[model samples]
Target: MVGDAHRAPETAAGRLGRRLLTGWAVLGFVYLFIPIAVIVGYSFNDPAGKFNIIWRRFTFDNWAHAFERGPLTEAMVRSLQIAGIAAIAATVLGGLVALALARYRFRGGALIEILLVLPLTTPEIVLGASLLSLFIDLDQQRGFWTIVIAHVLFCTSFVALTIKARIRGFDWTLEDAAMDLGAPPWRTFSRVTLPLIMPGILAAALLSFALSIDDFIITFFNAGTTETFPLRIFGASRNEISPQINVLATVVLLASVALLLAGVAARARVEGRPVVVLTDTDG
Candidate 1:
């Protein structure tokens, strides 16, 4: 009886702690979702207002305008093109660097790692100003390619970090076994290491693509006459807060959500769990 009485308080404490955690989680979710919900709601507002929510009515005119007449569509395409190139370039370079870092312990390894991550840690404004100055000095034209190069600089760090983390936790014995069995270094890497780290590489690429697409400050400085999506949005704000802006914002939000879901799905697949999509289909 005494033991049971003593255990009851501990059980109650555990329940209380769980409840507290659940409450905090819900609060955090609300904080994140509220702004997104507001933006989405504002996108559909018929008689556009400063606030996203309207007590008036709903319309699709803004979305139509954004897709058809506004600069939003062109900016979206440009952003996609730049992001695609940046993602591929960053992933290739960063993946190679990560592989080298993981496979070997060279002199100044720590310094190289620090240099790789320095861009990520530096202020965006500072990086943008420095890059702008460099371009001016080199007499390089400021346009789509400049933006792509700027994006690649920072995006590479993200890719390297992601791939390196995966490589760190990887089993090196399998790779050594492959080499020992008369496989070439390239073949061992392709057959063994590549397959193991492919998911991380994919995740890194997706993340880099998203970051490149959504970037503003660096792109703004590098992009002279060529307007990227974020630059267009910022330009538009100077004139008026059009409902078309809301539509573009909604598209960006949706894309971000989709990419996030994809990353989660990929991570789950990497961990060898049955993906949610397949489970839902089976059900």
Candidate 2:
């Protein structure tokens, strides 16, 4: 009876702690998502003026005419084109770099690694300015190609690092095993190695795409006459803040969310078996 009495207070304290932690978690989520909530909520808002900040009423008019603005739609399409091209280029180049670094121990490996990190560590302003100067020196026009090249330059680092992190301590002997089983090197890589690392590659590609699409400073420096979605929004903010902007942004948010869900589902399906890797780092 006495022991039970003593344990009762400890149980109550534990419950109290759990409740506090749950409250804190709820508050943290609210803090993080409140702005997102506001954006979504305001997408449906019917404002009296050009600015959609102050909500007057709710209407589906915004959704009905979401893509009616030709300039805005064109800018969005431009951004998508850049993002697609940049993401593909970055993913291919970075995937090769990641594969080489993970598999081989060649000369100048340390230097290559350092170079990979430099773009990531450098400030966006500095990189953008450097790119601008390079283009000027080459007498190249600052337009779609320049923006794509600039995005690829910075996004490659992110893609490489993300894939490297994903494949760190990964077992490359699996390749040897497949080769020993009479599989050609290319076939072994395509059939066995590719499947395992595909998730990481997809993740890196998505990251690259997101970065390329959302880039402002670099694109700002490189874009001479071309206007991306972000640039269009900036222009709109100066003149008229349209509800269409919010509508498009919300659409992007939803697409991103859908992609995230699909990736998660694919990962779950692929990860049924445990990934075997070597943890030893000794040479």
Which residue pairs in candidate 1 collide?
none
Per-residue lDDT over 175-243 for candidate 1, one digit per residue giving the tens place of the 0 to 100 score? 777778777998776666776778889889988998999999988889989999889878877665666
Predictions in order: lDDT: 0.83, 0.89
Taking all chains together, each candidate's TM-score versus the true structure is 0.83, 0.88
Off by over 4 Å in 2: 1-22, 273-283
Which one wins on TM-score?
2
lDDT tens string, model 2, 215-243? Answer: 99999999988999998888779778888
Per-model tally of clashing residue pairs: 0, 0
**C-alpha-based local distance difference test score of model 1:** 0.83
Q: Which ten contiguous residues of candidate 1 have the minimum total lDDT?
A: 274-283
